[model samples]
Target: MKSVNFKKKLTRLFFVLLGVTLVYQTGRTFFLKQEWQARNCAYEMVKLLFPDAWDRACDQYGLFCFNGSEKPMQKCTGVVESGSIILIHGLDEPGLIFEPLALALHRKGYLVLFFFYPDDQRIDASSRLLFNNLSSLSLAGPVVLVGHSMGGLVARHMLVDPVIDYAGARARTKVPEISDLIMVGTPNHGAFLSRFRLFMEIREQCLLASDHRWHRLSGFIDGTGAAGIDLLPQSEFMRHLNSLPYPGDVHCHMIAGHIFPFPVNMPEQFQMTGNQTLEGLLLSEKNYFLSVLGKAGLLIGDGLVSINSSVPFNVPVTLVKGNHKTMLANCFSGSSRIPPAIPVILDILEL
Candidate 1:
């Protein structure tokens, strides 16, 4: 009789937990959807009221040229002596990722240009836009392309796709001369985090919404966006891109980051001892859950991209000490320190 009663109570408890979970998930989804709708509405309003200002905003999707100054303008202002360097930003970036690097290159007398696009769109679409914009620019001398993350794939598409050639031929404009290409923290194979792109999109939106009056909107809770789908490891886009060969005319280089430092000098016995200790700790029922979490950090290089994924084609690569974002520049903290990859890039540019 006691056993029967216990079974009944357990079943009741399970149902109760399930009901609570379902309610919580449903509420969270509804909140996130509402927040997304509100954000879109606010964006439309600002875009309608301040058309010119909105166009010039870094957050907007467009190509901009900066001549030594931090302020970007439609046209290049000064003399082009050291040639032009176009900086292509990564997925969901608001065009500010290149600030530190752009300024550095500008100081070195390079004509710096920034290409911004709706990162949620298809990669080929963004590539075509970049190619079209470059065709419009009357740049003198060699042009170097520096791409970060997904930007690298965009650059590759521009270089590899026959469609670009067809467009240029039809337009009767010579394709822009690309002398060098530098890919920074690019997931050439694929990114593991891309599987969680919806979560990432929500996080980014929340950060953006935090700046506006709708900041509280994000307190509620996310892109099955085409670009996110393309970024998957086994996606058709990845297969197509990998099949193509990069142009031999342009010199290419990759910069990868290693956030975790593995012990190199430790004795084998010491290593074994450490592993045993870790195993003992992790074998406990309470701490067993942490094992996967710890392994994930080690496997997920620089938090987002694995080292193997960072390099696909056979090219010279420089490994730096920092995570994906930090290797380029500290987006937060005002980027006070010079990033590790900056010096390597400068060396490659011979600036």
Candidate 2:
């Protein structure tokens, strides 16, 4: 009788423990789902307000934004001022991203040329088109090329095009000649954030975890294959891209974003040490190593882009406070809560 009673007790205990575990697991899953939904909702709101900005991001080519249409191009109706400045935004970002800076530059008596390119096509095509348009207009004066992220790369393509003969091109322009190149949060070196397994998983989770009905949006993923390749650093692409020599006649400067303080709950891939919180990790050399290491070793960066990754070689560097996503999110606004670092880049350039 005693033996039978013991067996019955053990069976009851097993079922009780199993029930508790299931409840905990279910609750955890539910919490994660809720968090992801909230974030997606926020990003979606940003997308709505800045569709053109996001849509104009560089696709496969290192070109300015343009529709791949064969129609005769419309001449820029907007006339250039003496000290005109051209603005280029990064991959998946829009020209509006530079609105604050654009207004500032305008106040300084500088006209701004904002270019938009499709994220679905090669960047070179857009570059050729931008060149053709400029050639037709013969824009000449002192030009300042200001770009954020991939825009900087596109600007490099323009300033260094051998066919244009850097010096001769400047002499024949109808618009201002590009004299200075300012890149804000530009990933001249390439992104390390793309190599981490955890980073990819988290991105998948953020986009795929939510059933918030945004997956059906027209450019939600924007050329599934194109999106992934653009995010990753291609050695072949990089060699070709970096091989384009920097034009000696122009001055190049880059501003990098660095968020000294980070959230505690940030992903493990961003953590500097296995034992430290994200905030703690940002305060040490370990974080820098992660940023400067091999392709997969970038553990610390501007939320989305690594620090070393943003350095355009030999350009003067400026550091700001914010993460990659923060540049576009406008954290001060309730509807847009991104950081204010890259935006600050615009301010510096305008000054």
Candidate 3:
């Protein structure tokens, strides 16, 4: 009788503690700026109640075998003319983001292939997966790799470090006969936006949830992962990657976005006053600071990457008038105005 009473007391204590934890977590999530945090927190509570919820969601999205047999690539059905063009998307991309560009390339008689990966994984891991997928495919003629944002880093990794040695010294060679590598708004140095990766993950989850096929996994609890860490400018991964020489055979080009065209100009009134008073000196210093800040803003190309970051190692860069997101074809609105990068991409591929 005493043992039974003890067990009952313990059970009650557990319930009370659990309730407190839930309440605290809920409160914290609500206060967070990013809505995804709250959404994910609620999903966690539901998942705890229904252990099979995660599996059900994964199944609904056909992500049950996400990184397994479910081929990491989707080839567009069409006649091949200008060879195979592999379009690699960036961080947090749910694969559908490439639809507009893929369709455009497909319409141009190019065998367009979309390479999809679990973007939250390590950059090297994604690159290796790409290498494996490419190995399986018997790509005929020249293969042009077009990577956007972080995807460019993945492509570069595969090109620079393609050899994968298996057991007993069996090594796989790099993907051969590459024509050109066109990076669209790729952060060659690093992306400042990576610091706010939680927001990015949330944004991506929202994009995934909007699609019928991916709505189930809207509550998926994956963070930015190592890829986000590696995207930092001073990360060891970035340092090592930058140190490696780009593949000599592959021709590299960069298409950078310049959202702010006009240079910032300080007002004439802010100019230094020759008065020798301390107040005058302070005012002159403030004006100098403002001038420097204006120059820095201009360097922040596309709002996420700096102009210097976009054009690393002296790769020829073409500046287009649009922000990072707008440079790509408008997938949602079906805007009549062509995206600035599309024409430039087409022109480069033609050559």
Candidate 4:
């Protein structure tokens, strides 16, 4: 008839103006998430009245502490202190940036638990809370794992689950303790700004709406396993953290970041493809070694680790100042300049 009733009145006026612009952008994202939860509850009451004054740089840098209790073979303030270090911050961060690298590994005496997870959950409940706190804690020898940025993929699911106390020792006989891991600025390989956050999710907020792995990490960093390491198995959180198997002789490392044009500059082809150095972009296979340092000279990092991924597996990595969130928020804060990575974790755990 008359142009089919004016194209059904312009397709019901374009879905009624797209349903009133999606209800005024979901009521302005619920009042901007209630004003960012009232400004993080007034920045946790001014960080409990001005704390973080180099909180004794974790006892001049040695670190130590365990404490977890509520009954269970008590006595855990660093089981006869000597070897123990655990810190896994990232994703929304806070837990006092490992209190000055756990007071410098509790002043060289070691033992520094300092925990906290559930940064909006996933990665299988944060790798079952790091394999139930490393098979119900008591570790004091080889255990040294650190994280930052999805807490280094939840400390690589304690080396890809050779067995980590499955939901309370599922039927016992599966205890993994975790040897050594360190990852900062993470991204394993798949965060090239996630396609500018999925093109700002077509605006009006809901920018990837709290991550469903941003379009499966923009289709595994645009496929072909090169950077975006083929989006680690379409990420069920990096395919259960790339199904482990790299723990042989532990001591793995992959610290990356760059702040060049921006994404905070850590991309020399993502530090040469996370140090796997291109050839088919290696992710893991027990073979470890990747150290790419920086400080704005080689396109800075540490604001999230960028000198080709804060190298340190086969050792040799330095050059600090600050970035990657001002190296855990306080390398002597003036709100970012440099000087703090707790003196490079006390010169890389001094040995």
Leading candidate by lDDT: 1
TM-score of each: 0.67, 0.56, 0.67, 0.26
Q: In model 3, where do residues sit more than 4 Å from their true spots?
A: 1-82, 162-176, 215-224, 264-294
Q: Write the per-residue lDDT of candidate 1 for residues 1-351, one digit (tens) a residue.
A: 999999999999999988986686456444544544454455456557666554444244446777665343564433444477888987765456677888888788777888867666567778887877766556667789999988999998888888776235434645557889999989888775764555656656654555341232222211124565566666667888888876777798888777765322212111112124322323333454465554453366577887657755456667777897888788585647899888888998994
Per-model lDDT: 0.67, 0.52, 0.65, 0.46
| Candidate 3 C-alpha lDDT tens digits along 15-110 | 998898668545643443343344435545655766665555433221111111234432332233348787888887766655667667767877
Q: Residues 150-208, candidate 2, lDDT per residue (tens digit)?
A: 67766676667666444575565443566788877667666644333234434433543
User: For model 4, how does the per-residue alpha-carbon lDDT over 1-351 read when each residue is reduced to its tens digit?
Assistant: 999999999999999988986686456444543544454454345435444522321222222244432221222332334366778764444345555566556666776665554333344445665675566554545666778655776666645565553423433534434556766566653343322222322321232233222333222111111211212324344555555445565566554443443222333332233245332232332322222221233334444334433343343333344566555456453444333555565555665
Clashes of 1: 0
Cα lDDT of model 4 overall? 0.46
**Which candidate's TM-score is highest?**
1
